[model samples]
Target: MNDSSADSFSPRLLRQAQEGGYRLINAVSLKEQLERGSIFLVDVRDRADYEAGHIPGAICYPLPLTIQARLFKRWWLKKLLCNEGCTNVVFYCQDVNSLRSDSAARAAVISGFPDVYNYPGGLEDWVSRGLALETGPCCEPEHHL
Candidate 1:
């Protein structure tokens, strides 16, 4: 999660994230969870990608910010990402090939969010499954609530 180009992918980071105990979630289960309002979905891709399209109700806490270990522990972030009776945290990126969610999942796990998960299918699988996406730029933080 360096200041590298947005196209960067870190396999090592992904491996470390999985090894850190964040679980993988498939698109089917992700959709079900979303329908039930039982998971807090976070899009960890770049802002542009998020604006282009993303899962509805997903909080656009982009890659570079979500990957930071510091923000995950803050009170404001906890309020933003850990709502709904401490619902599970699910981070996703562009697709399975991207490591943004994995990196963010690892950070969430390290921050003591015991129910963190990574959605590898991401926007691609979601769209392939005919699931809908909300196309628009991110709104103010208060709007997330």
Candidate 2:
């Protein structure tokens, strides 16, 4: 296992960290998982970053604001709180070193989410691989001109 360096995390190193607790998926693996319908690919980037672009089918769940206090506390806990089966939840962020995806994974574990994964390369690596991403209407509009 490599030292946990938030600043210089490579996909290889990230894979090592993932072995212990979380399952880290790469772009190819994510694509396969998407086809299998066995994983939820979550984009943990900020709203602005998401507005710019994101993985298709990925939901905009900002890690810092929503993971622990909102999604887990409000939604995931309503069912059983502690016995939620280990479903596959995949988290991705703009950068591997960012606190967003890392904290998101930790929060998922704390929330009783069974299987938590992180996409270390994130959007940066995703696009680099010539993968197609989706873009939605930039933001909520006050009125439709």
Candidate 3:
């Protein structure tokens, strides 16, 4: 896994998130968060990729769809973040360097989500760590907006 440095897009996003007071959780920490529950994990990949495999319990909220429906969707996502008992809302994609997850995280922060997080390690790192994945469709059938 590549480290997000100052010059990279990932790091720039990371910095932006940090500037907005959002955390960037690593794979290990995210695994712990998953086990603890009460965290909303969002997979920002496309629907097909999400259906193929994703971190267990992650909701498929494709980045493209989110971007296309920015105004209302941002409000919807912020509401999800504010759901009762939710401690944090995390977004991830295929890899640590993926811009999709970063954009999603940024959007969440911009939407007034105080506890938004970017999981840079993403699904690849999660699988590399021997973590289990959920196959088939996510809870919502029509992931594409």
Clashes of each: 0, 1, 0
Model 3 off-target regions past 4 Å? 1-13, 65-68, 80-85, 141-145
Worst 10 residues of 2 by lDDT: 136-145
Q: Which prediction has more favorable lDDT, 2 or 3?
A: 3
Q: lDDT score, residue 79, model 2?
A: 46
- Per-residue lDDT tens digits of candidate 3, residues 1-145? 1223434346566676677566777776677777878578999798899999999889887766544665555556655544444558888999866777767777787776657778877898899989899897855424234
Candidate that would win on lDDT:
3
lDDT string, candidate 2, 1-145, tens digits: 1112454546565655565367566777787777778776777677788878998878776544644555543344314222454378887899655656766676676666777777778899889999989987433212221
The residue ranges of model 2 lying beyond 4 angstroms of the native Cα positions read 1-20, 65-86, 137-145
Estimate the overall C-alpha local distance difference test score of candidate 1.
0.71
Q: Write down the lDDT of every candidate, Cα atoms only.
A: 0.71, 0.66, 0.73
| lDDT tens digits, residue span 29-120, model 1 | 78888888888888878788889999998988765544244354333455566553564888888887776777677767766786887877
Q: Predictions ranked by lDDT, top down?
A: 3, 1, 2
